[model samples]
Target: MSTHVLFIHGLWIHASAWRPWQDLFEERGYSTSAPGWPGDLETVAATRANPEGLNDVGISQICHHYADIIEGWDEKPLVVGHSFGGLIAQELIANDLVAAAVAIDPAPVKGVKVLPFSQLKSGLPVLGNPANKSRTVALTPKQFKYAFGNAITDEESDALHAAWTIPGPGRPLFEDATANFVRNSPAAVDTHTAVRGPLLLTSGTEDHTVPRSVTLAVAKLYADNTASVTEYHEYEGKGHSLTLDAGWTDVAEDVLAWLAAQGFAPAGAQGAAAAG
Candidate 1:
């Protein structure tokens, strides 16, 4: 059976943010899809222009939306996600919906114990205002730099912000921040599942939004699930923008390698299948 890949983007970015990733995976003979969140606009400009439309979106709604998409797929897909999308990927895996899953700097799911000051600072743009819980929030370039581009140059950070940044729902951020304290939080994941397929969690060393500590905490949750495979990788000096930054291909190649090792893709194949 052909390996189908589902690419999910995180907040403060539109679905177009995964275009490069989709292209790279397709070159490796994988069919890929990047489905937008509910109320997501086609472009950053349109999204920024109508930010309020995303106001009421929460983690549960977004998770169910992607779940529906995954359910409709012709083949069980290899799910890959970044930040908030990463958490969604874990949720899907927990529900036994995906063949395998990769989460890159995933947002802290319920029970993640390490909450760095930097992470709180990065989230302050939305969490600072309780009113924002039901509103859309757009990150300023400065906030984006602190959260995602801290490891890159100023010029590159500015360029990336201009190209990929967009408004995202504040409710999900609030939901994640308070998930540990809330009963039956939407951000909770079933890490103890025996039926979940191979899972990989990648962390960027310099990431402030979802720091190494947070990813490590998340990795620990799956430690007892010996029935399935769980792996963790850390990229030094990389930030949350690792997937979209100048060296994004490095991370993509690493993920491709991992997928091959886990038997999700054909062994030893570097690019597309040969022409008939």
Candidate 2:
């Protein structure tokens, strides 16, 4: 049996953006897949052409969708997620679903109370209008630049926007934004539980969408769970685009190294696979 790695994408980014990571993990002998959020189409263009399927979708629905898929799998996967996907990754591990998880620049869960201005601004596109809670929202190039591409050149940011940006359901944003107030909010994760898979939470200091402060706060929330391994890493000059931008491999390589440290060798008796 081989270890499996599941990649989960965040808001405004199509699932296909994980293709590179999937290919790399496969080369290391791990079976992998990047399943889109519920209602995502087969391709970026197709999803953009018709995003109605995701309208009104919320965090719980998205979680259930992935949970169903994981339940069908033969082995618990090592999940790696970015942005909102990072939150989902934590939820999965906290719920005893996946073997372990890597949450990169993940949105703050319920217990995290720090709301940075950059994070607020990044979410305003959806949270600014109450009506957006029940609709799907798309970020403009300018908004994408501020929220995701600030650490890179404008030209590169624009190119990335054109390639991977897509409509994202506003409900997850709304759910997370109001998590601190909502009791039993779907965005809440069982961070206090001391018996779950090892978790690695990463942050890009330049990320506006989910600021480094928020991710660090999340790590603090897990500090009480001494029985489980929870680690944090910071990328000084990266932004939310670190997962898909020009330097994505660096972030992916770090994750590969962390997994090795956690004793998750590449499947099929392969030794720790070198990051290409």
Candidate 3:
């Protein structure tokens, strides 16, 4: 009775980014997968080398791609996503495809307001540029440091910059922030409503990209509606790079702990996996 878990990465990152997470979850006996974004595995490296190819993919296409992955799972798994991936997790739950979910520093969905200055600045790359209406946007070193790597060390941030920083889809972000998001296509951003499953939201205190308020704001919508348990956690001194940063294991441990508390782990949960 092993419950499978699916991990979805956010914008500009490839599924391979979840490799470390996969190892951690697998050790706990929960099966896992991080499906590639449409054309991501195929073109991310090349796109980063040139950055021009990112224009080929858009929000609609990426959402469809993730939806296909969710549909193919043997069973609805505990969905965990970061940034844009978090939006997809909620989209799946709304459609009744997920058993539970954990959204880490998730990007705000359609209808979710932007109240924090940090969030506005984090979104400037996409929302601020009119050209982003139909194009991809790459973050400069300064932008990345300000928006995503503020909490990590200089050395780690440098490595992150070298290996993972790349152009992200402009259309999906623009659509989430601008285009009517209540539709059923892509991520179900427009008109998307409160979910019906257990949800655990984790926010980094230093996460300028998705502040504590934004994370809790999403949880509030689900608090009174869903019978599902809803919880929010804030990890102090952590930044937007919570998953890949030095303290990622602590975050992972927190997720494991929360899932155990919810009775959401698979029946065979052992060692780090067992709530008992």
Candidate 4:
């Protein structure tokens, strides 16, 4: 049977944004799926037209949603996630629900203590207002540029915003912002566990949403897990938009190479090992 690869997207971007990735992975002999969060509609326009379904959704709820999907699969799949989905990917892998995971510019989990100013600023759209915890928030073009597209050209940023951006529930941001102070926080990942599947955490150096320092700290938390492989890769000039912008293929290729190194590459495929 072909290996199943599940792609999980972050906030704002629609799940359909993974179409290109799915196509590429399918051509490489892998079965892939990109399912949206609990209340997400099928298309960007449909989700944007009515975002009420995402109101008040939290981190735990999103994690459970994916877990339910994985449980129904015949084999444990490899998961790749971006931003908030990155955090979800870690949560799932830490619990041994998936075969392995790649978290790209993931949101800060519970144990991450370094809160950069850029990360804070990127989160203000949701964290600035206490009421947003129970509401859905949309990012303006300017906000989106700063949070996700700063490393790319303005024209491209604007185009991506129009194409894939959608309303995101504010609850997860609030949950993550306060995770360090809360006991049994949903944002917590068992980084200390040494028996789970291998994990790869990638970050873009110019990313304003989740800075390189933040991802480095996440990697540090897993330092003591000697039994499991926890690798970190950095893309010097990339940003949060690395997954949705024109440079997405570069990131995807690196991920495929990393998977190949871990012996999870698709059958009879080269896994784009050259990219690494």
Model 4 TM-score on a 0 to 1 scale = 0.97
Please give, for residues 49-124, the per-residue lDDT of candidate 2 as tens digits.
9999999999999999999999998788999999999999999999989999999999899988898899999999
Q: For each candidate, what is the lDDT?
A: 0.90, 0.91, 0.74, 0.92
Expressed as tens digits, the lDDT of each residue in 1-276 for candidate 3 is: 326788988876666777888998887778888876664544347757665555656666766676787777677778899888888777766666788888888877655565699888888888887788666678877787788789987778767766676677677776666533455445443222454677777889889888888777776666666455667888999988888877889999899878877776655664433345
Give the alpha carbon lDDT tens digit for every residue of 17-88 in model 4. Answer: 999999988877778999999889999999999999999899999999999999898888999999999999
- Superposition TM-score, candidate 2 onto the true structure: 0.96
Local error of candidate 1 at 174, Å? 0.8
Model 3 alpha-carbon miss at residue 156, Å: 1.6
lDDT of 1 by residue, 77-189 (tens): 89999999999999988888899999999998898988899999999999998998898888888999999999999889989999999888999999998899999999999
Error of 2 at 211 (Å): 0.9
What stretches of model 1 exceed 4 Å from their correct place?
Answer: 266-276
Ranking by lDDT: 4, 2, 1, 3
The TM-score values for the models, in the order shown, are: 0.96, 0.96, 0.87, 0.97
Residue pairs in collision within model 1 = none
Residue 153 lDDT in candidate 1: 93
